[model samples]
Target: MRDYPLENRGAFPPHVAAGAGASISLAPVKGGFVIHLLGDAKSDEAALKKALAKIAPELGADVRKSAPNQWFWVGDADVSSDRLTEIQAGLPSQFALADQTHGRVRMRLSGPSSRTVLAKGTMVDLSADLFAIGQSAMTQIGHIGAMITRIEDDSFELIVLRSFAGSLWDELNHMAAEFR
Candidate 1:
């Protein structure tokens, strides 16, 4: 897939907040990156986890298995692009890795109202009772393919393909306006 890299304007409107007994916020997380470890994770999960522990331990924290052979490693902006290159080269030969860093738009949504706004279009049941913290799923938001991960009790990182980020942000903000 072609990459659509975007410049961080740093002047977008606030996306996270609390008001009227409802709370939520959206913030641009700088340097959000991802690596698609698209391979046999089920067979090599233990070994892959071991290698990651020695190299980049943060990867093991939220490794989402969207399918039997498809896994995506979520990484924060703190992880440098150069480091991503290094890790890709160091992986075992059985693995097929792709640098999806520039392919996604990463946004953090937090607050009690955040889930409500997201649930409007999400297909999965997002009840905290079902999707607790640290859990993630590949689903659609605003009919756009998205990966939602509850990184905190009331916070989630919604990573969408770059092309859909802006529209998704607008849809999310529109839904959030009710609580704002």
Candidate 2:
């Protein structure tokens, strides 16, 4: 597992912006906050959403609600740790949270054929009618557990475990090349 290092300086590289058809690249969200709600309070969606509303505008467009009890706050890596600390303070005692700053990596794919590229490895239907922009789901792409977010009309972001980033990227990049 001697893959290249994480881009500690910024969110990720923008090289893929130049690729043809569907471009594949690491999303520039170096680290983000992953909220893990626990206990009975976890089911209080309104309270949780309200609490996060304080910072929702700050996170801007990167805020992702991947699941019922899972919310990801995406922002600059340097500010994420402090931001998570502030957020946890507002959480109820029944809830738990952690900063998955180094455990995850986001892969971005965009263009007309982008969904088709990911469909080769993911069982989740990436059709726009079902998974529209601003929606996200926690699912598996091949053997990798990923949080897939449809960022735009033809753009999707795949958040995967860092341990499988290399292998997963290899698999996706291989399929995406055909669209080039």
Candidate 3:
């Protein structure tokens, strides 16, 4: 019999390069948690939000709407199994939770040129007046599907499938090259 050991690795290299003068910085948001929440037809956004706040107040996770009655609860800390179970059990009967911590990868793209780089690939209006802070759009960057959320005026967080993270990262680097 053979025994195998597993190791955790990030989607990008340890020291990923950024554009010249850091005009556009890109880095993997490793070691965090991504929880997908789905609500039934009878469950509305307001009800789900209220229930989640009452149930998992300690999580401090940023909630991003991915679709109607669907949201992704993201945080910068890894959640424990016991905590996850508690959250799952606390959800209302109309809501369900799926742990996507290991299934998805998050990347932070910031600096003044972040929007310019993203505009090259996605059609979402990155204008401040249109897509204000906390606004999230599930769209495609090049050929990769991702959730782009404006975390700040010059910063965006991208959540993509783990398998496609590397591809998306490479594409972002290329898109940001002209700024270098």
Q: Output the number of the TM-score-best candidate.
A: 3
Q: Estimate each model's TM-score.
A: 0.80, 0.75, 0.90
Q: Show how many residue pairs clash in every candidate, following the order shown.
A: 7, 2, 0
Kindly report which residue pairs in candidate 2 clash with one another: 11-28, 12-28
* Local lDDT at 28 for model 2: 40
Residue range 75-117, candidate 3, lDDT tens digits = 8876776777788888788878888877898999999999999
- Give the range where candidate 2 is weakest over 10 consecutive residues by summed lDDT: 1-10
TM-score of 3: 0.90
Over the stretch 109-138, how does candidate 2's per-residue lDDT look in tens digits? 777778887888888887889889878888
lDDT value for model 3: 0.85
lDDT of each: 0.73, 0.64, 0.85
RMSD of 1: 3.6
Worst 10 residues of 3 by lDDT: 1-10
TM-score of decoy 2: 0.75
Instruction: State residue 121's C-alpha deviation in candidate 3, in Å.
Output: 0.6
- lDDT for each residue of candidate 1 in 1-180, tens digit (9 for 90 to 100): 223444545323555455646677777666755777776534576677677677777555356666676677776645555666677677776767676666776888888777888888887888889999878888998778898989887888887887787788888888887877
